[model samples]
Target: MTQELVAQLFGKALSNPILDRMDDAASLDIEGRIAFTVDSHVVSPIFFPGGDIGRLSMTGTINDLAMVGARPLYITAGFIIEEGFLLEELVRIVASMRDAADEAGVQVVAGDTKVVERGAADGVFITTSGVGSIPDGVRISGSNARPGDIIIVSGTIGDHGATILSKREGMDFEVELQSDCAPLGRLVEEMLAASSGIHVLRDPTRGGVAATLNEIAVSSGVDVEIEEEKIPYRGEVRAACELLGLDPLVLANEGKLVAFVAENDAAIVLETMRASRYGADAAVIGRVAEVESSRPRVYARTLLGSRRILSMPTGEQLPRIC
Candidate 1:
């Protein structure tokens, strides 16, 4: 893209003081312990029900930092566009990215664009790197769960994954299913303030809540026990998954987070989460079971009073649902 075209394309859509500078690189003065993460978005239908690739890129990056208990600060986006991609569509995606960044209170400090031959790549793919500052005394990680820690989900699961599946496969259930794509920085901050005993904070993305809890269990050397009836999932998402022969537990989520907090603080944390904007349907799904002699794992109790092992996904259930 020429200087003028680049300016015309992004000079205004993603214009921030630092981004508008249009220098070779960006300089940041982030302070304290910062959480830095990088992610790429290639969801098949670049523009899904709730958001586009641009919003997905920014929100996913910011949420990754939020998962680590950090307040997001800055992000850099790189776009790979196809040769025949529509300029109008490109502008819409950029505008989505700008809106998402503004809502999340983060800056798009730097970015790069590349055009590939026709059919060389998807219509558009975005890669974003984010940086955020971790507040003092707030230590959250996938490896921090303990026996008796309570597992709480921020909201319904499988929304994002199911929405993509619905759009990709042209399955609509009359109810418009949209991806739960939203930034959770403020939500995380609220939970942290409610209690310092939050042990684990993880986003159930590609592998869903089952994979995330299993990871926490093994990493923290504790067994996990969840109730099937307690896992919150939307009606439309469940319907879509059933139609698609997909497992809701294994579906991805973009705006959902699973938190493992100390038993004493569990109630307060869940209450705080419920009060947050993105946590209206928050539910306490399970708890860390007593550690066994073997490697830690996850187990789910069915509504019929039966228990079953919740295994880690041997492979991807649905590729590129992020």
Candidate 2:
């Protein structure tokens, strides 16, 4: 049955008969260093203000590969569809995926589909795996942050999480909030070109900027300090976060990135990012520091001349948020 499903989803191959075996894994031949990343999207209401699962899946995977200074090339998607899922909605998703892939200049070379009993799955769950090539002389990682490096975020935070929460909870806000679900490869490319000594590049998804910074601090064995006044947040998102007792820093962001670069090149890098479509709100929010304590920590400076520790999220503040 699975073989038949595969045949229906992907046509038969002529060269390799083993391809018809419907194996769980697919092998690929490679040359230089390759980067691979996988992500699953289960955003509530599937159809949100800015995008759906299909576009989110593509962007998420592409951005993951791009964060490490990799040029994304291809993606493989696996879809789990509910039995009663609407075919029209599925078509729309596929179209959106195509559009996203085209915009990213990546090919959807492979994919799979499976149907589950109605209640067993949500409307649809998308898993995307992407492969990209890392350019020579480019090294970027979470552990590369150094003392005196300036941190810059691509854009405003909490848009994606706020949009999802509003739609899921059916709360009407004064302004229309849209999710910042966007591809960041181009933005990363611009930043890399403007400066070569980029210490780290991280997309503040899942647990948002706070969790991302904490992860970087621990990995790089350095202290990070951010001024709350410098972090950008939309008014509507701020109001929503207040109402829900959520910190905007802890909310998820899909279209934002945190970059660590040398202090001298920070302004040029920020200018490059600001010129790009995805990074208009780019700002130098923080800096890396050598930790004197036992473990690395993230600290935020408030407007009232107070400091607070930023830690990883304890529990799911919001569920099914991409």
Candidate 3:
């Protein structure tokens, strides 16, 4: 069964000579400054509206590397399946991973598989680790954001979380919602090409934009202020969140990214992002400012012309919506 699963992964899309060797470890020929990232996906329904656990695991790790201004090169996957899981389902998941990898131009160089007792695990869980090469002279980090930097978000927020919540609760909204689960390597590259002044790049996944910006503020010792009206969000998703008593700012997003760039080059970066497929809805939502207190802060100016503190999420609002 393990061998069959491995063969399925290597199906037409993924053809890597190193992976075909079936070795305990993959021999990579990468050099220069490299970025390594690992992520685990355990969304409740292994299959979601726009993606599955397989695609999530792959793109999540790939996005992690891209966040640090790296070009994603290869990824490795590890899967844990519960007993009695259908072979057809596994094949479907593997196909999703292949398609994502192919789209991102990355190779799945190695993997591991394990099966457990029926009640011991979910239908399936996936862990992915990715390697990427950072270009020369590129420097990006959470702590790199500085006062006068402009903040831009890739697209509409909360789509992924809303889609998952709607699916799990069986609540259908007036408009269809799909998870923004996409590989963002290409988008990051374009942003890099547009500006060398980019200081920070982040994918708002689990805690969404609020959490990510808060982390950046603390790390960089800067205060962030954004206009609530400027942040892009689908009207249908907002309505759904209001109906469900949830906050869209804290919702998860799989494909979107938040970039902190120098004010001088903000226009070009925003232009570059808006030109990309995943970043069509890109908007400059805010700016970083000198911190007033020893502890940095994140503030959102509401549509009512009032300021409110955007605090870090204390607990997981939606469990396993990754």
Candidate 4:
């Protein structure tokens, strides 16, 4: 298109001081250690119940940086639009990205766009990258979960996964299911201030809570035991999973995070998380088992009073639902 059209798209909605000043390349002032992350969004249908691909890309990248205890600061986006894609839709997506970035308190500093042949790519795809500052003494990692640490999930699981599934299947469940896509950077900052005993922080994204917990268990050389009843889920998500013969524990969550906090600080962290905007429904669902080799990597104590090993799905349960 012309310069006028491009300017109208990002001129006001996403304009920022750093971005406006940086014509060719972005320059910087980053203090302390920098946490960098990138993610691509190609979720099926492009637009979903709660968010579109643009919002997903922004939140996904920001959350990745937050998982490592970072204060998100800036973001870069790369977009690929199909040949016949409407310019109006493209502008709308750009506006959505700006709104998400604003909510996360980050600036969209730069971006690139490319148009491909008709049917060459999905209607639109976006790749987002982010950078943030990690405070000194904050060293969160997947391998830091220690025995006696309680596992806490930020909020309801399976909402994003179920929403995509319902929309894909054209099933209008009695209760409307919506994607829980959001930015978690602010939540992480509050959590760290509440307690310095946080060992690990992970957002259950593609592989869901089960995969994240199991990965942490293996990485930390410990076993995990989650009480099924304690796991949070909305009624509509539960019903959607039941109808599809799916397990909510393995479903993806765009907004929620699972943290491994020392037992002494678990209560404080839970309270802090519940008080945060993105973590209002936070709950402690499990703990790291002291005995490493005695049980499976990750297992759940079912409501029926039995434990079952939570294995990774042999194949993709919900493909392209990210």
Write model 1 residue lDDT over 1-322, tens digit each, in one string: 3335644686688888898888899998877899999999898788988998888999999999999999999999887888778888888999999999988899998888878788998788889999999998888888888888999999999998888777765454455888999999989989988899998999899889888988888888899999999999898888777666778999889998999999999999999999988999999999997787578889999988998999997686653343
Of the two candidates 1 and 2, the one with more favorable lDDT, higher being better, is 1
Model-by-model lDDT, in order?
0.87, 0.84, 0.89, 0.88
Instruction: Please write out the lDDT profile of model 2 over residues 142-217, one tens digit for every residue.
Output: 9999999999998899999888888875555555899999888888888888899798999999989999999999
Q: Evaluate residue 60 in candidate 1 and report its C-alpha lDDT on the 0 to 100 scale.
A: 95
Q: Which portions of model 4 miss their true places by more than 4 Å?
A: 1-8, 169-175, 291-296, 318-322
> Candidates' TM-scores?
0.94, 0.90, 0.95, 0.94
Q: How does residue 210 of candidate 1 score in lDDT?
A: 81
* Models sorted by lDDT, best on top: 3, 4, 1, 2
Compare the candidates by lDDT and give the number of the best one.
3
lDDT of 1 at 95: 94
Candidate 4 lDDT, tens digit per residue, 63-147? 9999999999999888777877877877778888988998999999887777778789979889999999999999999999988
Report the C-alpha lDDT of model 3 over 158-229, residue by residue, as the tens digit: 999888888775554545888999999999999999889999999999888999999999999999999899
Cα-lDDT of candidate 2: 0.84
lDDT of 4 at 41: 90
Error of 2 at 243 (Å): 1.5
